[model samples]
Target: MDLLIAWLLTAISLLIIAQLPIGVEIDNFGKALVAAIVFGILNAIVKPVLLVLTIPITILTLGIFLIILNAIIFGLAAALVQGFRLRYGFWSAIFGSVFLSIVNGLLNQVVSR
Candidate 1:
């Protein structure tokens, strides 16, 4: 139940992010939902491993490297998911990931209350 809510919130966040002219594009709600699921799965499975591998760099950057890590995962999702696109490569992925994180956080806060 909680997982469902998180997925829906993530889908909503993706749709909202798509509205911005930030070089991230989602063709429709269906694609956004699919992308959200993919993003969640990647975050759960791949992100942790990547984080561990980059811990030294992450420490050197005072955790700022996580943003680039997030962007890489975001770009990976765009590549894997149909109808979701990141038009401007790494920069687009970075900004899109940041906005998505903010929107998802806000939505989760509202939903939790």
Candidate 2:
């Protein structure tokens, strides 16, 4: 149940991010959940691989390159979810990714209390 709420909050955050002046829209909550699941799975599975591959770049950029990697992962998750539609451009996805991450972090912190 806690996980469900977290995913719902993530979906809501994603929706808001999409609705921002520079945002996009997720058409269905169910699909958004699926997107979140995909994101988690990918983050656990592929993220480390990507991180390893980008080690030099990440080191060179002083870890700032992780932001771009995160955006790419978020975009991939959005693409995997059919109902979580993102008509916005790359910039919106980047911003939306940041928006949702921050919102999720805040919510997690509060909910864990």
Candidate 3:
């Protein structure tokens, strides 16, 4: 149940992110949901390895480099998911990931209460 709720919230966040001017585009709700699932899977499977590999940079940047890692994963997700596009390259991915994280955090807070 918790996982389902989280996934739905992520999908909602993706939909909201798509509406932003940052050039993250989702063709429809179905695409947003699919992108959310792919994004979650990528984060779960790939982000840890990336974090480990980028530890030096992450430390040097005082953890700020994690945002860039997140952007990379976001771009990968957009590449893998059909009908979802990061139209502005790395910059789009960066902004999209940041906004997505923010929106997801806010939604999670509301849902948790």
Candidate 4:
């Protein structure tokens, strides 16, 4: 199914991101899969509410605050997963989220076609 494919792709993207020097680390594919699920859940549930609450700051910052919000969610996901970690704290989360987005976009494009 499409949802299964997307989940696997997200896990793969997490693994790819871990291989980079961006301070995101995943112990194995299993952990990557778990992290991906948690990340997806948090994005789906928490992100929208946070976005609404931070509208003023987001507007003031020209939408740049979304990056910080994404990093916070990324860090939260890492916190909830045993084998997934963001080294260097918030800085790592910021880079990890950015790279994750990039890698996911690339992987989805390949998988979709």
Candidate 5:
């Protein structure tokens, strides 16, 4: 259920991105769901490993680098998912990452509270 909610949020995010100045296209629910699941799994598994590996840099950057790492993870997830296309171009990825994080946080808050 939570995962489905996440997928729905991803779909909305993709739609919003497409409408924004960004060129992000999510063709359908299947792509959105795939992107969400892939993103979640990567965040859970790959992010931890990367964080540990980059602990020194993370500390040096005062954790701000984590935001870029998250953006990279989002870009990677979009790259891995078919039918959902994202042409983030670094800054766009950052914006898209922030957007996704905000939307997901709001949804979580709304549902949990």
Candidate 6:
């Protein structure tokens, strides 16, 4: 039940992110849902490994490299989802990832309460 709620919230967050003027675009709610799932998968399975491998760089950048790593995953998700796109390419991915994290955090907080 918690996982399902998280998935739906992530989908909703993606849709909301797309509506913003940040160059993240989703063709429809269905696409948003797909993108959210893909994003979550990558974040779950890939992010940790990447983080461990990039520890040196991450430390050098004082943890800022994690944000770039997130952007890379975001771009990967957009590439995997046909109807989800970043209008401004990598820049859009960066902004989209940041906004997605923010929106998801806020939404999860609301739902948890």
The whole-model lDDT of each prediction reads: 0.96, 0.78, 0.95, 0.94, 0.77, 0.94
Write model 3 residue lDDT over 1-113, tens digit each, in one string: 99889899999999999899999999999988899899999999999999999999999999999999999999999999999998899999999999999999999999999
For all the candidates, what are their Cα RMSDs to the real structure? 0.6, 1.9, 0.7, 0.7, 2.0, 0.7
Model 4, 1-113: lDDT tens per residue?
Answer: 98889899999999999999989999999999999899899999999999999999999999999999999999999999999988889999999999989999999999878
Tell me the TM-score of model 4. 0.97
Candidate 4, run of 10 with poorest lDDT: 1-10
Please tell me which model should have the higher lDDT, number 4 or number 5.
Answer: 4
What does the lDDT read for residue 113 in candidate 1? 92
Better of 1 and 6 by lDDT: 1
Candidate 6 residue spans exceeding 4 A from truth: none
- Give me candidate 2's TM-score against the actual structure: 0.85
- Which regions of candidate 2 deviate over 4 angstroms? 1-5
TM-score of each: 0.98, 0.85, 0.97, 0.97, 0.83, 0.97
**Which stretches of model 5 miss by more than 4 angstroms?**
1-4, 7-11
Sliding window of 10 residues with minimal summed lDDT for model 3: 28-37
Clashes of each: 0, 1, 0, 0, 0, 0
Off by over 4 Å in 3: none
Minimum summed lDDT over a 10-residue window in model 1 is located at 84-93
| TM-score, cand. 5 vs. native | 0.83
The total of clashing pairs for model 3 equals 0
Q: What local lDDT does model 2 show for residue 48?
A: 90
lDDT of 6: 0.94
Instruction: Give the winner by lDDT.
Output: 1
Deviation of model 2 at 12, angstroms? 3.3
Q: How many residue pairs in model 1 have overlapping backbones?
A: 0
